[model samples]
Target: MNTTDIIGTIGVSLILIAYFLNIFSLIKKDGNLFYILNIFGGAIACFSSYLIRFWPFVILEGTWAVISVVALLKSIKKPQD
Candidate 1:
């Protein structure tokens, strides 16, 4: 495998590990920011794997990241009792 592929693989792996850890309670899910950032970073790294050749992942990650960030921001701003 090429260096780019290796690097991308590592990045994706790390993100997935982090994601699952959070979900399983091994890591703290303290706030929306963490979720948003991890997903956003994962999506970016996954999309980059396509290396400007195919663009499916680009759209998938882009939409997911945007939605995640928006939802996170909304949650943070909502009034609390």
Candidate 2:
């Protein structure tokens, strides 16, 4: 596989890892690691989509990345107990 494919695979892997961990109760959905993985993975995936000029995935992953960033920011700003 080429570099873009490798990057997309890694990106998708990271996203799936986060989801799997969440489903198995290995990590909290609101945890920093979860959002971090999502943001990075989505960004990488979005970039890969852009490289291939795939508009559908570009929109999907771009929205995912943006939402993840917003969640991360909100989490950081939230008052801890």
Candidate 3:
């Protein structure tokens, strides 16, 4: 449809895919791919939320994106099991 819709859809799709994969044991939560999906998904979702002037979702997705980034860094620094 619109640019906003397209972006939001992609973001949400990534998040959902990650969740689905995790639930089915296809991917580990601590894996880089998981964090990557969340980082991009949350960031894109946050941007779309901001575009729509939705403060709640913007805050939520922004926090999610930031936490994902931190988690990714920590995961990288630490040894993987």
Comparing 1 and 2 on lDDT, the stronger one:
2
TM of each candidate vs. truth: 0.60, 0.96, 0.94
Summarize candidate 2's per-residue lDDT along 1-81 as a digit string, tens digits.
Answer: 999999999888999999999999999999989999999999999999999999999999999989999999999999998
What is the RMSD of candidate 1? Answer: 3.1
Q: In candidate 2, what residue range of length 10 has the lowest lDDT sum? A: 6-15
Model 1 C-alpha lDDT per residue in residues 39-68, reported as the tens digit of each score: 656566656756755567666655656766
lDDT of each: 0.65, 0.95, 0.95
Q: Evaluated with TM-score, which candidate comes out highest?
A: 2
RMSD of 3: 1.0
Off by over 4 Å in 3: none
TM-score order of candidates, top first:
2, 3, 1
- List ranges where model 2 is wrong by over 4 Å: none
Q: Give the TM-score of candidate 1.
A: 0.60
* Error at 50, model 3, angstroms: 0.8
lDDT of 3 by residue, 10-75 (tens): 998999999999999999988999999999999999999999999999999999999999999999
Name the lDDT of candidate 1: 0.65
